[model samples]
Target: MAAVELHVDNRLLDDFEAIRPKLNGHEIGRRSSPVSDDVTVLTMEMVTAPSHARTMEVTLRRVDDQLRVGEIHYWDEHGIFIVPEVPFREVAG
Candidate 1:
């Protein structure tokens, strides 16, 4: 797959960091990188409970001059920290 060519700002990282503490689940493995054609993916394995584990993928696409978060997929449940069908704008440098 062709990797997405988008620049992600540090503030989003900061936002993620800030949001982590408030999350109910603890992240196991996390990855954020370009996937295909103007789409970047954020994947994370989360342990919501002692034995409940789920992996989620969040796809972000470039729209006009902004990068907006797109679809999200998970194992069985809706992904964490995401509003359905809502877009997240990339933080400006």
Candidate 2:
């Protein structure tokens, strides 16, 4: 397989960077940076988000031919903060 470009969606990466600051003091549950295959995982320890007051472990991974989301483990935290999907709508905004 001609290695699939891992970063096919740079917009996703850029949006991720914008929220990294809020993840300071996070406890990375898992992380892996592979160089031989198209699969990679980036985990971060999240402490204070835009609307949360607890720590969290976030895992971002890409493999096979699709993207997936993992459950956010937060104790007493409201929930995860995520950017809206980039799906093309039938009507233009």
Task: Compare the candidates by TM-score and give the number of the best one.
Answer: 1
Model 1 lDDT tens row, 54-82:
44444556567555546444433333432
Error of 1 at 76 (Å): 3.4
- Candidate 1 ranges with C-alpha deviation above 4 Å: 1-11, 34-93
The TM-scores, one per candidate, come to: 0.31, 0.26
lDDT of 2 by residue, 1-93 (tens): 011112213335554564445444432443333542333344443333323324333455555744444433343234444442356869878
For each candidate in the order shown, give its overall lDDT on alpha carbons: 0.41, 0.39
Q: Residue-pair clashes per candidate, as listed?
A: 0, 3
> Alpha carbon lDDT of residue 79, candidate 2?
45
Pairs that collide in candidate 2 are: 26-45, 26-46, 27-45
Clashing pairs in model 1, backbone N/Cα/C closer than 3 A:
none
